[model samples]
Target: MQKSITNQNQENIKGIIFMVSAVLILPFSDSIAKWLSSSYTTIQIAWLRFLIQAIILIILSFSLKYKITGFHKKFILVSIYISSSIVFLFWGLKYLPLANNIALFFIEPLVLTLLSVLILKEKLQKNHIIAVIIGLIGTLIIIRPNWSAYGMASIFPIVSAIFYALYLITLRQVSTKTNSKSLQFYIGVISTILLSVIIVVCELLNIDSFGFKQIDFNDWWLILLLGVITTIVQLLVSKAFFYSKASSLASFQYLEIISASILGWLIFKHIPDMLTIIGAIIVISSGLYLISHERKNSKT
Candidate 1:
């Protein structure tokens, strides 16, 4: 019994480390996207991000001999949802401050809880309902100030969060059936294909944002860095979920705001206002409350 407890504790620690690392590193990619969005359309940046991801994963698969074979039909849907999540996030970054964008996106865990209740047939406790309400209120607090400057663009991260929550649901279903590396590889492949098609269609329709414009080496390097960051973040998150009960790591996600705020200030000279900071605190608190309650309920 002691040995088992020790092993579980070790796993929990590992999960926390991985999850925190993943969330912290994730903001760097968003910062890069914000940097590049000045010169590229959101769609183009999204495509190149995944294109490079697919390429790296392909090379890694071949070199490591990782026979990645999780090509289930659901992965295609996962691709679509995750693709939308990222594209929407990129769109948000173009208009909103990085810290604010990431803070608003933190609503995802609440969204995920609600989704679990609806789709997974989990019973919705009163606390879950309360959390969602508080989460939405927090979202509004942040949006209220940004509305004048960013208007509808401020909500893009929420849209991104919703699709991302959906992606998480589908991902939860398939995650245990295959290796994380394989799942990530297929997601890259499918997202690359799906985004490519969308970009082509948008280009044909003469959509300005999806046009294939020329980019210099600077853009190329940022895209490369974005791809690497995406890959690393996903792997770290996967390891986190694998090693730890997600509930234990829920609070660590808030660390992202720190990194994002730092990046925003340093790279873009943007900072979240007091209202946005309060809103983020509320949302993060509610999410932590909801997840912790859920974990307690599960234990009981």
Candidate 2:
């Protein structure tokens, strides 16, 4: 009994540490992406970020001696999720404000929770319903859409959120049936292919000449660092989820809002208004409560 308790405590500590590390790193990653988005088209930046991560993922997978599996059903689902998410995210960032964009992206957890009921056949608990409400209200508060600055920009992030939710739901299902390394590999492969297609089409249409235009030496270094950060943050996120209960980790997700809010003020000089601050607190409290309650029920 003592040994079991000790092991459990150890796991909990490790999980909390991993989860916090992941949560903190994500905002920094977003800040970096936001910086890069200034110089490159969002799509080009997204593509390059993943392209570099893909190469690193491949190298690490081989070095770690994870098995390279042949393609399967889950691989296809993974591919679809990755491609859709990358496309939608790139397009969304082109329109939305960074904080608003991320707030909309937070809609993913609610969507994922609902989808799990339909697809994974998970129960639609009361907590889940409440979470959806809180998330929706939070989204509405953040948007407060205006025609001049917000018109279509408001729509893009919501669409991105939906696609992201789909991606998360599908990824969860696929993860259960396959190794994480394999799932990661296939996602990278699919995204690289998808982005390559977008790059080719951009060439054919001569959309902006920006996508294929030459980047300076400094930008090149930033892009390289962008790739490295992308890969590392992903690993940290995976570790967090792997070590902790999903519900526990899910609650910590709201930490990104707090982080983004802080970073936006300090780094970008963009501060959340009173409404945003209130909405963030509401969202965070509701999400944390729901997650903790769910965890308690699971234990019982």
Question: Model 2, 116-195: lDDT tens per residue?
Answer: 66776765666657766776577568656676776766666667667766665565555555555666666677777777
lDDT of 1 at 215: 89
Q: Residue-wise lDDT of candidate 1 within 68-154, one digit each (tens)?
A: 774788888888998999999999999888887887787776777667656756565576567667766776686565457778987
**Least accurate 10 contiguous residues by lDDT in model 2:** 242-251
Model 2 superposed RMSD (Cα): 3.8
Best by lDDT: 1
Per-candidate clashes, comma-separated: 0, 0
Candidate 2 Cα deviation (angstroms), residue 153? 1.8
Question: Candidate 1 — which residues are off by over 4 angstroms?
Answer: 1-13, 121-146, 243-251, 272-300
Model 2, residue 164: C-alpha shift (Å): 0.9
